[model samples]
Target: MPGTPYFSPRLILGAAAMFGMLLALGIHILGQRFGLDLGDLWGTPNGIIPATAAIAWWLIAAVAFVGGYVTASLLFSAASGHLPRRLQHALIAGGLLLLIAAGQAASGPSPVPTLHGFYNGIVALMLGAAMAFAGAHFALARH
Candidate 1:
């Protein structure tokens, strides 16, 4: 690895963020193509999310988990000297997922919370975070 150009961990994190966002979008689009109907429950009456919608959210959370896993793995491999171990990787991956979510929240107006209700966003966030944390924790596990 001598003579190889060195890159900052921040730069790697930024790239991971972009990669995670794109991965999330691609997964979402693929889900839609498969008739998942991600927005089907956007404005349901009485803030009720049916079984199908719950299933859809599960898929979304799965995608989020993959995104977080890939991004964190990429960063860990790219900057092994920076990240200490499993706990740090999990934390970093979770943070990267949150960064992706924050970027998504900032990109445009999301009517999900306003129209669908706050629980939708909360559920998505919690599921996504939990899965992402688990994914990252296992990504570098010795098995």
Candidate 2:
């Protein structure tokens, strides 16, 4: 029964950290891709607050992690036999591909700016993949 016990907290924390890193990195990259001054967020009085940003990042990370965990858990439960592993791998790959496509789409000329959207989508995809991987690892390890 050692492996039977689900390490929910560990999985959630690990996934959240991974998601946060990816989100920060993706934000930085999108800012660079399109001419956006990250520092500008500090120009105005309420534009940027280090503490606020950190809190926002943490909130985002936690949400992404929970979402990923739930998705992976559901998928794991629904899949039969070898299907879980295969589905997990496929979902990760598909998510990456969707992220790339979304990024490309966002980069295109549009009436509304999509830089943030593209970055968020990519970060979510990355987080989802991390979650899927964590779930698969736990399931396999326990099995």
- What is candidate 2's lDDT per residue for 1-143, written digit by digit as tens? 23333445455445534543444344434444444333333335765455533443444445445444544454444443334667678867765664575467446664324765455445545644564455444533443
Root-mean-square deviation per candidate: 9.2, 9.2
Candidate that scores best on TM-score? 1
Query: TM-score for each prediction?
Result: 0.47, 0.35
Candidate 1 Cα deviation (angstroms), residue 63: 1.7
Question: Tens-digit lDDT track for model 1 on 74-131?
Answer: 6666565554578667866775675566466545654444544345444555555666
> What C-alpha lDDT, on a 0 to 100 scale, does residue 137 get in candidate 1?
52
Clashing pairs in 2: none
lDDT of 1: 0.57
lDDT for each candidate structure:
0.57, 0.47
Which residue pairs does candidate 1 place in steric collision?
none
Q: Please give the clash total of every predicted structure, in order.
A: 0, 0
